[model samples]
Target: MDADLVECRACPRLVAWREKVAIEKRASFANDRYWGRPVPGFGPADASLLIVGLAPAAHGANRTGRMFTGDRSGDFLYAALHAVGLANQPTATRIDDGLELRGTRITSPVHCAPPANKPTTEERDNCRHWLDTELELLKPTLRSVIVLGGFGWQALLPVLAGAGWMIPRPRPKFGHGAHVRLTGTTTIDLYGCFHVSQQNTFTGRLTPLMLESVLASAGRTAGLLP
Candidate 1:
């Protein structure tokens, strides 16, 4: 499934933008080879925790080919996950960086990198099937999800509902620390967290302690940790 997902060119705009960035190359990483394709989710298949992020950064994941890699957002996120014992390392510089997530899988609503870091509504809908399939595969062991930002929170609702998780009417609002439980053949809890974007972290809108609190709470809820 992952091999097939990386080859998708379902959204022309995203394809162009990602390829353009790959060709132009950020000055800092000018000499490095860019992955320039859809970034696939990373982690063990039996993970109990799922993290849904918005999308790959144009120069980050699009370049490194790993979700949140080589970006400030990933630095903040991995550090928090490490502090909570979910990740083995506090860095996700590249795909083979020896950083491993113990009981969590990280994915995004849209697999492709988008222009200006935002995907169009159509692009999101087109990419929904990937998340849907992922959730179906993860449903057995997945106990909790940490959705980063409102985009991921909104994108995941219908997918989870489609997977037979009973979503509440009107839906739960998105906010840091907001949580909702969906019960079905398998029960899963969803928790919202501010995205680890520079806009949030640099502005002090999402501090380390705040991220750790949410991750720790979710980890405990999922039984990843005592």
Candidate 2:
């Protein structure tokens, strides 16, 4: 079922651009076929922690079927996840690379690759249904959400509020290890960190160690590790 969604072509514009990029980079990902459509969420479905990224990169996850894979952003993210003991492997170069995630899952608010890495408000609204369904399926056992960047956090804030939980006073801001605890039957923790995109990493906005520390704290809060 999840596999089918990865091969989906529901968004025509996304499909065309994805194919165009794949063809342009033919030599690099020669044997690699573009997942090129809508990249589905990755990691354990029953995970206690959900890591929400902004969106797929043009040549990254948009080309590979897996989330946060085949891109520079993924390189930093996977390294951090592995350091925190959530991933069995530290490297994610392809879709079928046999990497495994433990007690964690990674997803994006927008499934399709957007032009210039920015999705319009309408596009994000259109994709919200998928995220809603995803949260519903995982809500039973979900314990925490780690939003990767301001955009990802913004997209999820309303969803949490709509679930009958009151948001914190002053609201939670997006920063490394910034967290909020919801007032509800099951308390869910929200943490924020800078996105692991090339711009951020290259500019030293988010260091590798900083990201690893955030994941380490999340694992502890969710009881996935000590």
Candidate 3:
């Protein structure tokens, strides 16, 4: 699955943009070699808690081949995770940075980096199947999900519904700290958080404590914490 995922070119615009960024290179990271392909989820496959964000950052994951690495947004997120004891380190600059996640995983709704950090609805839907496949594989242990933005929140509900979880009519709204539990043979707790994008963190819309609080809640719910 990992091999097939990295080679996906289902979206032509995304294909061109991710590859173009890899070749042109960010001036500050001119020495860096870019992943320039679909970035996969990171952490143990048996992770009990999942953090879902938007697409990979242009120079961040797209360059490092790992989700949330080499970016300020990741710095904000990992710091929170470390404070809450889910991550061994508060920094992720490279794929092999000695970072580790404990009973948790990070992923994105869209795998490839999109132009201007925005993917069209078509592009988002085009990437949905990969998430579906991932969820199927995660069903045994994925008890909770932390969605990082409205885009990911909107994209995820349908996927969860399609997987046999009963989504309430009119659907749950997105907001920081919003929590919804879906019923199926097994239940899932869905959490909403503001994206850790520079726009949010820089403006203080999402403080480190706020993120840590939610993560702690999810971790306990997933039985990853006391």
TM-score (all chains, Cα) for each model: 0.99, 0.92, 0.98
Off by over 4 Å in 1: none
lDDT per residue (tens digit) for residues 1-226 in model 1 = 8999999999999999999999999999999999999999999888999999999999899999999999999999999999999999899899889999988999999999999889999999999999999999998899999999999998999899899999888889999999998898899889999999999999999999999999998999889988
lDDT of 1: 0.94
Please, what are the lDDT tens digits per residue for candidate 3 over residues 1-226? 6779999999999999999999999999999999999999999888889899999999999999999999999999999999999999899999999999999989888999999999999999999998898888888898999999999999999999888899999899999999999988579899999999999999999999999989999999999988
RMSD of candidates 1 onward, in order: 0.6, 1.9, 0.7
Off by over 4 Å in 2: 1-4, 7-12
lDDT of 2: 0.83
Kindly give the number of clashing pairs for every candidate: 0, 0, 0
Tens digits of per-residue lDDT for model 2, 25-70? 5577777777677888998889899999988887788788779888
Error of 1 at 40 (Å): 0.5
Ranking by TM-score: 1, 3, 2
